[model samples]
Target: MDTVIAYLPSILRGTWITIAVALCSILLAVLLGLLGAWGKLAVSKVANIFADAYTTLIRGVPDLVLMLLLFYGGQQLLNDLGDYTGLWGYIEINHFTAGVFTIGFIYGAYMTETFRGAYLAIPSGQIEAGVACGMSPGLVFGRIIWPQLVRYALPSFGNNWLVLLKTTALVSVLGLHELVWESFTAGRSTRQLFSFFFVTLLIYLVLTAISDVGLRWLDRKYSVGVRRA
Candidate 1:
């Protein structure tokens, strides 16, 4: 509809915010995932227990519940602490920050399992051989571990990313003005709900299709020389 076209810019802007939030959230998730995997794999029993607990706790909760709890509860907690100590003024958590960290925190558990499985797939003998060849732990990780870890983990990682991308829509509930919110408002004003929402659906499909293509390319690049069964 013409009305949908007229509101295109606002929808696109919301799409961009959705993309930004997904990117930042994925980055944070990856960082936390790496730390969590390391903790799970570490020699220290306490580290292992802590990592296990984290993954368990996150898995037990719904993403929406966790997001709302963090956004509202975290904001309140921060202000309350600030009030009690008088160390700072009142604090507020913006929608973007809240969305990014909440999603990141939720997905990091899944990534932990992904990375852990990938790491487990690597033969320990290869690492022992690398050590035998006078390679340091860091060098062994960089040379022998990183590449295969990526190759093994990437498919699951890609799946997680797609899921995370769709999950960005959930942030609309927090008044983030993301794609869903923009489309909803546009449709309400124009009384052409299907038109605006259909456009939103197309944009999401395009994004997912593009991501799938790029991930496939990376898969091919990493799978080089491997004999496919």
Candidate 2:
């Protein structure tokens, strides 16, 4: 108990790092998803092909394999491109950057599908009605499409967020010093692996519990005119 108490600060710091990484990854995923959804829905064949390829390739690969490949292989590719183009010198990729980009890029595919489906679920007639009302395209989207898109997307978004939070543990493999890495180090040093891991497990449960509550609140907020069965 004393040892656990003593390591509390370290664990908290690691937890903070974990949260930071996860938030950044989610933001990136949302941005990519919006863009991918737009690309897929666009009239351009090139855009559709590109969006399809991106989603297919990302979804097909295992996350860990993609992470490792992106971290190591991407670094090599960047350096090679730099050397070839004479645009810059050899560049180093930090684990934090690598981790965030990898997780975000990987999950962006899932988000893309979520967003695309949500957008499609909106009735085209509503959009047409908005246009008939003399609403600009942007205004039409904001008033009609965006709200429903968010409502439809929230469930899948919440699920993706939960999974993304758990996936942050993988960053430890890159030596990012997040919760899992910190817990593993403390346990190894104290020779109390079970104790440390038990604490880690509890913290994760708390995080997910809090997330569930927050997500529910959002669901209620967005579901204001919606009637449930």
In candidate 2, stretches whose alpha carbon ends up further than 4 angstroms from where it belongs are none
Top TM-score: which candidate number? 2
TM-scores for every predicted model: 0.97, 0.98
Q: Residue by residue across 109-195, what tens digits does model 1's lDDT show?
A: 999999999999999999999999999999999999999999999999999999999999999999999999999999998889999
Candidate lDDT (C-alpha), each: 0.95, 0.94
**Each candidate structure's count of clashing pairs:** 0, 0
What TM-score does candidate 2 reach?
Answer: 0.98
Error of 1 at 94 (Å): 0.7
Please give me the total number of clashing residue pairs in predicted model 1.
0
Residue 56 local lDDT, model 1? 100
**lDDT per residue, candidate 2, 20-62, as tens digits?**
9999999999999999999899999999999999999999998
In candidate 1, what residue range of length 10 has the lowest lDDT sum? Answer: 1-10
- Candidate 2 Cα RMSD (Å): 0.8
